[model samples]
Target: MRRSTRLSLALVLTAAAALAFGCGQQGRLTSPNDHASALSARPAFDPSSVRVVAAMASQDRATPALLALSGVVGTGTSIDAAGDPVIVVYTERARVANLPEAIDGVPTTVVVSGTVVPYARPGGGPLQMGTSTGNDLECAAGTLGCVVVKGGVDYFLSNNHVFARENAASLGERIDAPGRYDAHPICNQTPQCANLSQFQAVSFSSNNTVDCAIARPISGLNYSAAEAGGYTPASTTVAAAVGLAVKKTGRTSGLTHGTIEAINVTIRVQYTDGIATFVNQIQTPGNFIRSGDSGSLMVTETGNNPVGLCFAGGSGASFANPIGPVLQALGVAIK
Candidate 1:
């Protein structure tokens, strides 16, 4: 079943001015040649090479202004056909004009990305990763990204908006599986939705870097780390980089695969409370996720190593928080 909490694309762009997480405040971009000059010779086009890093820096520097543009929504670093690094700009409509061909010697590419918003409302059955879950106070739901271990206790992982009500939920608030939206007519009646979880922690501060939260399962709740589709993610995590092949199993979209289109992304996401700017994020082309897919865990296609936590999306792209920082911020490790 679908929920009607989807945020409009126009609302997301309008809220961009209220930057959260220090978006667009990083230092200015430097010349590409200067950045390359500092690194020792390496194979040309190495994704981690100096040129790519320089382009990322340039992207960070240019994000603020680009986001301010009429149709622009976000920006990130990418590689061009020649293997040279370029800055990628995400927009809400067709290509935005007047965007400079290059920024600080780094080329730029504009991609149409509609309006990106948090995926909420949309899961059932056993308490499992990638299934539907959410706080009991709302009629909505979102994907349970994965399982995690914190302080030796196992917990359910997902976006803050899913488990903590975007920082409005009190500690110990009840969380339900199949979410109220999925539970439908029975959710508010007898044999009400199962209360298998409780809010443990959520980080949604002004300087936050992740849109994540963890919940402790009530005693005796049956749960598993395996996602919907029997895809078990590795306990180990990997850093996100451009071109990495990744996959995720979510509530709305069962299982989907896509390439990491960009890295070190800075984008604005529209939430129930307001807009939030996320930096150092990972990006992938659209179709990887959809409404109700928030909280899906993005992992390497081959190794199943966790790389990012799916959160927001737009017309042509989706965004995630790098798993490294997410785990660190929550003081947890993949289970």
Candidate 2:
């Protein structure tokens, strides 16, 4: 509905569930047992041998940060060691105030809403999916997704657009971080359409002007396996060397490859269907993003080190906000 940053909003969370969808941040809920149960219902993928990728919230778990946010948001090796998601919770949460006791899943988040603290990237870093189901939600309330681990509780993550109309994410909203839209017959806008579809809103994510939101999946849903898909992880090395080959994967365009046209260059972007535009903002070209490619992870070809994440693209070109901003905004690490 509106625009916001995923990480920045997550920084001020707890009670966002009711405020979600501009209906007063009433979040969703599920049981740990339900997560396990979902696994049986979850689609399968090749965890041992697979290419990795990343996204705000999807069913595919072949790449790192599988439907989950990084503890320290940055380029990390996509691996298949965990499932479920990383949750961000405030100690003073209102409804799910005592959320922990009521929740299951591991690699949890318990930072305060207004507290500005330096967070340490957990040992698990960003996750790579072992299983997948590539589902997503548009922008709604009460919907969420979760990231499941091998033996841990799942966390939540969502789009900033979902909570764009709210002051901040509320506490105690039962949601599936990185959710898939599930068609509901009762509330079916379309007989075959899902209420929220496969996408879930577990955490606070963004499409912010300065920052993109990304958070841990906190409840319900299962995020078993890590990220996996048809894309390759961009291996990279330090020093943004020129002529480096890179690639990207997005919801619209599958996988596209390009070179580091230039780093630290200015670019322009479109926020809405309006005729206005944002000009010459800092940008990177390693991964040129087209429409619907915002938040696409851009990596270097050398060692797969993350170089940038897609922000915008135009005039036969693309732009990104560098992985550094994602890390700074999320208070996490790269690995």
Candidate 3:
């Protein structure tokens, strides 16, 4: 079969499998009855717990002090030695102003840190597992991973670097399937490349919470919870925990599985342009992810409940922004 034909068949088979397993019938991951349940299942470190303070800090009122005092990163919840909920406050310096007795009544701790940057580039791999980005840049294509709905519109999810070009792209940019690099030579020249338009982005300067963005596909385009290599995600999200068994489908590695190594991580990531710091993130062991897989979503094996949004990694370790804050910011729900 032709590459295009094979890809189409793959999407159809995926949708069929999703229907068969009730993982995402009709390409929808959450139903009205289950949306709340899925959101609630995303673990104890809830984003709602830190929303107010996060908003305040975003406005730049004592930014460092507020962020540290609130113990609010992307989402507020951290972990303790007993693996219980704690508040993690990150600062460039040891002392911050008005360090709180606790955040939302959770015990608070402070850590010195630097900027968290986005991971943009990675090496090559064969096509399999899940969807990929357009042919624009070799390192640009990541995984489409899953579907989401916002304002009653369907959107495909991936990393900002994958879709938005790491804060350098404009709204309504074009994204192609198999990415430009992974697509055929004639894919872009002819209209053979199945493409989507960049619809929305949570820009780095805007939220800096999750390295996330969404695209609007053409009306007849196909979506599925069935990833490449016949993997299906649960129709919900599981709260992330240390040692949780997790999996992801991406462009480079296909379907790779690993365990959650740590939670509530604060670290600096190096992007091409400069440095960006991320706080309250999740970490996975091994080089579970490579270049071209930056946008893959991390989910628990049980019911495939989403846990994190994979973005940057190095030294046999990868990081993801918790999913709760990501979806909340985008006004979208997993499909």
- What TM-score against the true fold does each predicted structure earn? 0.60, 0.40, 0.56
Q: What's model 3's lDDT at 222?
A: 44
| Cα lDDT of model 1 by residue, 107-126, tens digit | 77665645542222112235
User: Ten residues in a row with the worst lDDT in model 3?
Assistant: 116-125
The regions of model 2 sitting more than 4 angstroms off are 1-209, 224-227, 230-241, 273-287
Leading candidate by lDDT: 1
Model 2 residue 307 distance off true place after TM-score fit, in angstroms: 1.2
Off by over 4 Å in 3: 1-129, 135-139, 185-207
lDDT score of model 2? 0.32
lDDT of each: 0.70, 0.32, 0.57
lDDT (0-100) at residue 192 of candidate 1? 22
- Rank the models by TM-score, top first: 1, 3, 2
Cα lDDT of model 1 overall?
0.70
Better of 2 and 3 by TM-score: 3
Name the TM-score of candidate 1.
Answer: 0.60
The Cα error of candidate 2 at residue 52, in Å, is 46
Deviation in Å, model 1, residue 146 alpha carbon: 0.8
- The segments of candidate 1 whose C-alpha lies over 4 angstroms from its true place after superposition are 1-126, 186-207
lDDT score, candidate 3, position 215: 75
